[model samples]
Target: DTAVSQTPKYLVTQMGNDKSIKCEQNLGHDTMYWYKQDSKKFLKIMFSYNNKELIINETVPNRFSPKSPDKAHLNLHINSLELGDSAVYFCASSQVAGGLADTQYFGPGTRLTVL
Candidate 1:
């Protein structure tokens, strides 16, 4: 009965390799987001999708792609992974209720390591 879940919580690979992280939410939310937490513990939003439609997309590199198969699922794909791409990727979901945005529920996070 987890609210959010991610597969392969830990990914270890070499540079230039391609990888993808899958996320799913069971909260029946309408919006999902992809965030990255750098080594310095700075959290930044990369992409957001509302009802499977692209919304907020930060100034991230083209190698990073966010896809929402549906309102409850969001996935991230990284191409030619670089050392800079090594970070903790987080998946979050939120919904508006009574004209107010609810607290975002985050997954445990997927730690991607590039050698």
Candidate 2:
């Protein structure tokens, strides 16, 4: 069974369009994170949620937003997507121990193509 999963594994959209990616975890973790991997495969943290509360918000543009309805779900919403937004978005969940994340489980990733 997949512990972490994301919907619409592949996303193709035009520039300026808005999109959203849904993620869920069954591991019962209190913390969830969103990471963006650019074409060069450089992964950067975008957002983090702990028990449905925003804990860490990276320097991403305001157009990008992370929403968590509950502890098991973390969703990413992008408004007015740009060409630079074309990349793979990954969702991960982990249990924080001693102020650090432990044994993170990552989703398959959602590839967004902006043309």
Candidate 3:
């Protein structure tokens, strides 16, 4: 079965439009997150939620928002799309790991392009 899934694996849009991508996971884990991968392939966390709680990534732009309706899903919405927003967006999740090691499994990613 698929662990993490996202829709619109490829998104092409014009600048100044609003777009949203959906994500879901079946791992039954307590935490879920959104990450953005820049053109340089650097991955950064955008938002995280565990059991319906929000944890923000300090470096994320205000234009990006995350929402989780329940433990199994987390979605990202973007507003006023810009060329700078053209990047890969991935949704992932993991356990708190406590003091142990935790590896976040990522989705195939939604490749968004803004012109």
Candidate 4:
């Protein structure tokens, strides 16, 4: 069984549109994260939620938002999508270890294309 899953594995949209992607994890972990992988293959953390509380990355734009209704699910919403926003989005989950989060278990990414 998959530990983490994302909906709409592939998304194609036009610029200035809005989109949302959903994620769910069955690992029973308390911490979850959203990451973006650019065309150059650089992966960066966009947001993280621990026990449903938000921790956003400073570099992430305001257009990107993460919402966790509960510990097992985290969803991403992007407003006014831009061409530069086209990338592969990944969801990951992990548990705390020694006062810090442990290794993350990632979901199959959702590839978003903006035209």
The best candidate by TM-score is: 4
Give one digit per residue, the lDDT tens place, for model 1 in 1-115: 9999998799999999999999999999887888899999999888877865675555799898887777778889999999988999999888852112678889999999999
Please report the TM-score between candidate 3 and the true structure.
0.92
Error of 1 at 36 (Å): 0.3
The sequence of per-residue lDDT tens digits that candidate 4 reaches over residues 1-115 is: 9999999899999999999999999999888889999999999988888875688889999999988888799999999999999999999988872123478999999999999
lDDT of each: 0.86, 0.89, 0.86, 0.90
Give a tens-digit lDDT track for model 2, residues 11-98.
9999999999999999988889899999899988888888656755557999999988888899999999999999999999888821
Model 2 poorest ten-residue lDDT run: 95-104
Rank ordering of all candidates by lDDT, starting from the highest? 4, 2, 3, 1
lDDT of 1: 0.86
Q: How much is the lDDT of residue 48 in candidate 4?
A: 81
**Residue 105 alpha-carbon offset, candidate 1, angstroms:** 0.2
Off by over 4 Å in 1: 97-100
Better of 3 and 4 by TM-score: 4
**Number of backbone collisions per candidate, in order?**
0, 0, 0, 0
RMSD of each: 2.3, 1.6, 1.8, 1.8
Which of the two, 3 or 4, has more lDDT?
A: 4
